[model samples]
Target: NVTVIDAPGHRDFIKNMITGTSQADCAIFIIAAGTGEFEAGISKDGQTREHVLLAFTLGVKQFIVAINKMDTAKWSEARYKEIIKETSNFIKKVGYNPKEVPFVPISGFNGDNMLEETTNASWYKGWEKEVK
Candidate 1:
């Protein structure tokens, strides 16, 4: 039998969590470069955040941190480096090796750092270049 599903762990449907985690071969983490951060903790009614952070924390082997929203932050190398610094610390706390982590800052809003020639990312290399 072969079936696949795509949905996050949440009160609306947390059942996916068990099956998703158990069956998935790998995971890709997509974080925004500027905003869209959902605070880590239980909500007012005690509902925990259904976020990829937990999955990443639990040790997803093939996690690629896609930092979206770079245009909003102005596509600066120093800013991206700062994001790397903070994310590296978080990855360590979540039981992952910071050295093995990779990051690519992309602006989904403006498509600035997208799948094309990014004029501003002179300081950082492209995503395909990361693995090699």
Candidate 2:
């Protein structure tokens, strides 16, 4: 079953953390592809690790990582891969297999690689089953 929650980041307001994550079975983690943003989000002080760890602890085993705002990073595959490498390592540290994770390159504003595939992300492996 699928339920969408616009859960606030731990840094934003952690008061809702427990309630928001309690209902989730999986996560669509949207990290940016821009310079510094990706790094900052996964850093020790960032909410990404805390929130993801919380979800995992709460039994949210599935994950779909959406690397948003590819446009900002000029759709550089290098940048995408870089973030993926860093994130994959961290994800593994949290006890998940990096190979099973789906890291999608997207531009939320332009909807690149959302439904239809975009040339910008032509290298991305296409057509995984939608989350249901």
Candidate 3:
């Protein structure tokens, strides 16, 4: 049985986030790939970095990073790679093994790479196979 909890990412709801994460076996971190958005999220004051560190501290051992908003970035492979490189480094610092994490480029707005492979990201070999 799988229970999925949608924890709020806003800093104001960090207490609620912690409560939810404490019960999670895995975390699916959704980071935006839009121009400048990714940078802000990974910045020193970003909630992405904060939540990731919180999840790690609370012992959420498994992580799947979904780099969303690919449609905004026009599904560029370079943008995907850039987010992966920077995010991998951040997660590594938060105690996650970069090799063990599954990074999937997605577009929640367009429904790409959410449940199946997206032609938009042809350059992105599906991470699900590697994860399993």
C-alpha local distance difference test of each model: 0.59, 0.84, 0.89
Q: Write model 2 residue lDDT over 38-75, tens digit each, in one string.
A: 88889997777887788888888888999999999988
* Model 3 lDDT at residue 39: 91
Residue 28 in candidate 3, Cα distance off native in Å? 0.4
Per-prediction TM-score to the true structure, in the order listed: 0.65, 0.88, 0.94
Model 3, residue pairs in steric clash: none
Candidate 1 differs from the real structure by a C-alpha RMSD in angstroms, to one decimal, of 5.1
**What is residue 112's positional error in candidate 2, in angstroms?**
0.7
Worst 10 residues of 3 by lDDT: 123-132
Prediction 3 global C-alpha lDDT: 0.89
Model 2 clash count equals 0
Q: Is candidate 2 or candidate 3 better by lDDT?
A: 3
Runs in model 2 with CA error above 4 Å? 127-132
Clashing pairs in 1: 33-68
Off by more than 4 A, model 3: 128-132
